[model samples]
Target chain A: MRITERQFVELIRKRAPSAGGGATVAGLRHGLRQGIGDDCAVLAHTRQRDLLVTTDLFLEGIHFRREWQEPASLGHKALARGQSDIAAMGGIPRYAFLSLGLPRRTGQRWINEFLAGFLRLAAASKVVLAGGDTGSSASGFLADVVILGDVPRNQAILRSGARPGDEIWVTGTLGTAALGLAVLQTGGKLRRSHAAFQAFCYPEPRLRMGRYLRQRKLASAMIDLSDGLSIDLARLCEASGVGARIVEASLPRLAQTPLRHALHGGEDLELLFTVPPERSPELPRRLGGVPFTRIGRITLERKLWLIRDSSKIPLPILGFQHF
Target chain B: MRITERQFVELIRKRAPSAGGGATVAGLRHGLRQGIGDDCAVLAHTRQRDLLVTTDLFLEGIHFRREWQEPASLGHKALARGQSDIAAMGGIPRYAFLSLGLPRRTGQRWINEFLAGFLRLAAASKVVLAGGDTGSSASGFLADVVILGDVPRNQAILRSGARPGDEIWVTGTLGTAALGLAVLQTGGKLRRSHAAFQAFCYPEPRLRMGRYLRQRKLASAMIDLSDGLSIDLARLCEASGVGARIVEASLPRLAQTPLRHALHGGEDLELLFTVPPERSPELPRRLGGVPFTRIGRITLERKLWLIRDSSKIPLPILGFQHF
Candidate 1:
């Protein structure tokens, strides 16, 4: 059996000292506030702000197929993924560093469109392109995007902050992106206006909602749903040393989407977070035009479960696993 | 004609706003102090220290061949390359974020050896592996390392700081790395004790020397010789809006190495810096056991020339071009 990405990360974490583990340079104290297991590595920047750094690898054929998506869409997704990490940390994305490896046959026009798409979002998000390295790839194109963001000092929402009594909530409808991919896989047109197509191609990170939740101190724990609900929730619970039980009927999805898609599909780029029972009443039904759905609650036992029509069943931890 | 990496960078620079070009986040006055066209992106971290960030991509088949080097050497070089960028900036590397994409056939043993090599150098350099992302590669293995370092505010040396009449100095023997590569290409056995082999396999970044030069205010500008002498010098000159004339006789190289390897060969990873004539006397001939040689001087004319046997000739800007 192949080792999962989580296991690999654990291997690294065990081998490499934690960032905040009292690393010193010339007897001066300088260390990351948070590292590895979180969405973004948090570094103490200034007295006023903490820096959030997140790197995402967007590899060709593995992460996306060139034939299925346009170069512009690829560019957008590349930056969006990292921004979602920042959003999950309740941070504001500021600068982006992109290391790109272009294949031999790539043209100047393709690069221009890619930059156009990337810069369009950067401009909208107020993130500046800082610096990066470029190389000639032997095979397909690859891009690793590093997003730097800022959050109030010691105020970042973490996956380990969830308590057993916290209720789990999510922003936007689930599984729409997987449905879009399903259509694309079956050779359907990418209708730009369609919600499913839009969700897959031009998926937006829940930056505003995350910031609002953090500012209001409403969320106890947060993570972006880049993977499926089941796996990402598993990660959050694992980090918190707790489990979760979600209601199947409360899961939000389009009419055409199967329950499996909502439960196990990936790349939705929505915000999944937990709130204390007392804070749940103050949680908005909608924020920044995105619907918020409450479908789960953290559990004391270390097991994932789904309540379907009053019947409790184990929830399969199925999502995209790179191994 | 294929577009050169520099041209592609220029295209990006023109398309995206410069990092320091008044980028605002929520009306806050935060921006990068330096961005593209440098060894590292400089960001204002605190009143006492500035942060330096540099990302380097090491692609399989492009940067190195699997058969030519061990997985450990590959890992060492990957981290070393980014550390060299930090060294070139006269900064102390504090943290590293590695995004790795492993091919399908990669085994656990290979990964363990790679991390051993990477972590060894990281321990020596006092760099903590803060965070990273991992994925499965469809083709060749790829790794991109992002290094974060710190320097005294406004004290980090830059390629743009060179001025006319400045003496150009370099550390260690040039072209030894290329010699090692040539030996490898010719099916020669790798002798670990050989300087050339060592140079190519695990080139040491001039971190201590760079810090000494900066602390003493001896270097006006600095750059790393990752690309060959001719091209890297040209880049430094271009960034500084000046030119250079190097004496071929003064180039430091092994007795067995040809001059062409010093002039046109790449991946030496030595520090190439500019010191004013008045400050040259104060510069050490050797620092931290590495020899330093004065080979050139900044010129008023904006042209690169090689002074060989008292005759001047154009220095062909021939180095590694990844286009």
Candidate 2:
């Protein structure tokens, strides 16, 4: 049937009478009271703490290729990507929901394997899968994960917290994922010595590190590097109403050749933040054995600059745009 | 750049650091406590409730066609479908996360309209959109909405509550959406007088009613109708380890044509329920002007029977399915 989106939606609404309570499902009425129509859905849990909500989509051809991904790995990556967002906000993830679009030709074995991978990660993180919807697709497989986390009433981190004079730091190594992508594209096998390859295959969420920063009241602002360093840093700076200047020698780059990969490579999933210079020394060089490095500082200049050797250069604004 | 899902997930894990003490983000961990490998993620909540989680996916061509829907309506319907599952368990929805995969050719205006419709419904429902990831696609649109809800300690209503001899009840009108679909498919223009058409266009959720059912201590078992009556009823019966028998004349049908539509049509969003005989009459026939009817009774026969003018016949199942 050639169902328009509207007709499909109407079909969904028709099921309501048996759904539950009238007042509870009256989304429009409740939405007005809670400010639900904005960019994100807001839920007030306490006087100072309100939950912020948002969602994203990743498609097979648009985000990755099936030929390159094992079904299990695809499932794992989907949840991790969403979890990173909660980590970015310095929130503790409590629950997750996954919606998958699979083709008829996809086997039940594939579905089970994917769920196994996803559920494994979710269990390790203490993230519970709450609920979701499922359907078939004729095009390709699609996975969407939604995550819920809690932030302290007054301490939920935001991208807009950076200020001029704040020193910037990053967790773990960067650019490995991008370089890994290069290796995968070239069909080059990973050498035993190439830790970057491993870094690319399994990007971890720095939930513990984020929580520490929020609890210690260390970072003035923070963001997780899902996009490459240049674009994500630019985004953090933009949200903070500030600029940044990074020293080449200060960055924690992978032990790989092309330095460009470290700078512009995406999917790093690392935490980037700013602290007062006085607090930088008090911060550990590593947290839970993950290396940390001071890479840059916030600036009032409102521009992103990179220092290579002794030459300062302007960084490009481009990042991975799905479109 | 091409990225494999395994490669992508590995990168995500590499970036995330192990849990650290007293940090906001670092403290939250992934992977199960029993060390991964589970169908559901177990989460520890503040109220001592163990949260169980799962996700499902819905896609365009596979689940519904764009030619039959409106963008806003599609968005709203997406959220509603997920919400129904939450309601099925009599849980209170707290958060929602959406991941959308749109074709590159899809315009921003369509996205805005979809979000407008979605947010409008989400706001009313008090479902906060937490965090999701987005990417582009080459084919159709995909929507995955994840929902988080909480049930009281040991108070969750499950599909396994019905008993033999429990009377079955349904809330609101049935077959309207299916009829609406038929009309739309037959190229029958919608007349202002056609409530079925409106029902097919816009759906309401019984969130309040579902909550009420739970709070009032009334139903023995409940489920929402997404896949037509026969299929969903069978599911409910399966879950409860029982069977059912519906009096054909007692089954509510839309005033329009085709008794088949009411019997096997999908997307009604109504609640199918079972209650003990004594409590059946005490239950109102309608809520908020939506009608209710006694359609069947749970039995131990392990079969579903349709009673037509004192004659018994086996009812065939017809509904949407992935396989």
lDDT of the candidates, in the order given: 0.89, 0.67
List, residue by residue over B189-293, the lDDT tens digit for candidate 1. Answer: 877999998999888988998899889989999999998999899999999999999999999999989999999888999999999999899877798789989
User: Candidate 1 — which residues are off by over 4 angstroms?
Assistant: A21-29, B19-29
| Model 2 chain A lowest lDDT segment of ten | A28-37
- State the lDDT of candidate 2 residue by residue for A1-323, as single tens digits: 13333332343334221112113221211321122211223343333343444454557786777766567667777877767776776777765655566665777567767777787788788876554445566787776666756666546676778989999899988887788778776877776356656566556778888888888888888878877788788878877889999997877876673667667777888888889888878788788888878888899999999888889999776667665
**Model 1, span A136-161: residue lDDT tens:** 99899899999988898788999999
TM-score for each prediction? 0.97, 0.83
Largest DockQ belongs to which candidate?
1
Task: Give a tens-digit lDDT track for model 2, residues B51-158.
Answer: 334344657776677777678878878877767766665666665556566676777578777877877787787665543445566788777766656554345566
Best prediction by TM-score: 1
Residue B137 of model 2, lDDT score: 65
Each candidate's number of clashing pairs is: 0, 96
